[model samples]
Target: LEVRQCLNHMTDIFDLIDAGVSPGRFDLAREKLKKKFGEDAAILRMLEGDARWIELWIAVANTVKHPKKTERIVVNDLRLLPDRRIQLPTWQLFHSTRCLDAPQALLESADIVIQNLLGLFENLFVVVIDQVLPALPSGLQWVLDDIPEAERDPKCPQRYLLSIGMRNARHA
Candidate 1:
């Protein structure tokens, strides 16, 4: 559920660059961008490796969000048996073009899932900062701000601010 939401948010970035791209359809967006620009486009090359992972994540998210009659294989918990062995979630892909013969555990732990999401976010941020933002009409781009002491948590140490000024400019 959360993964799906995060993917949707990520899709918004692509949509901002080119309107009419559907949310959570990064594959389609990639193809559209590649076709519009070219296969040799820098951003597309940078995003090539991320496409597979995003597809898998999309499959996992969709399977969990919209289950069918034979799609009841979402195990999402870590357990330790008396034998002292760790057991991770048994997440699998059901209806993805990735692998149709048989499905395997795509996501095992929350840590990995979070790490993947963060990695994708960082890559996207770099692409936006380097390529997308400068081409925007209003020059609107993201800014990072430190979390206030009153609202700060160890887990979340910063917040994003969308600024309308120069790149990396501190908005007062």
Candidate 2:
């Protein structure tokens, strides 16, 4: 459930990026983005390359959001195999639409999804700096500062400070 929420939140971010309709709808946001940016856009190409995994995640998230009796994530389930081997307690997600030969471990899957999203965000940040930032109108422009390695958060090394004009530059 939490994983689904996180993915949905990402869609919200996408909607914000579009600055258009579809507040929390991933499908609409994705389509609008492609239409606005064109298929050849770097951001769109990046998403296109990761389409498979993204679809799998969407399926998993959807399964949790609208759960059916047989198609539900199994949390910390332990199983005994036919050969009497013990399977450790593990989070698993299974749905027929996105069938896995074996159940996918949820923790690892969630970690992968998050890491991929973060990587995509990092790439998008570069696009913003190179393409979007320069196009901003005058006073609306923000000053961007890259945090020093030693001062940056370990988990989020790409952290930067953005302030509007010199008045707030002292904070950075």
Model 2 residue 101 distance off true place after TM-score fit, in angstroms? 4.3
lDDT of 2 at 68: 95
Off by over 4 Å in 2: 13-24, 76-87, 128-131, 134-152, 159-172
Query: What tens-digit string does per-residue lDDT give for candidate 2 at 1-172?
Result: 4545555565544534543444335456557777887778776676667667767777777887799987877776778989999766566667887766465565676678778877656655655455444455544556667677799788767656766664434543
Q: Give the alpha carbon lDDT tens digit for every residue of 55-157 in model 1.
A: 7667766667777765444444677868999765455444645433343344634567777787677666655554455554555555545346577466773
TM-score of each: 0.62, 0.62
lDDT of all predictions: 0.64, 0.64
Note the residue pairs that clash in candidate 2. Answer: none
lDDT of 1 at 31: 89
Give per-model CA RMSD. 6.1, 5.4
TM-score of structure candidate 1: 0.62
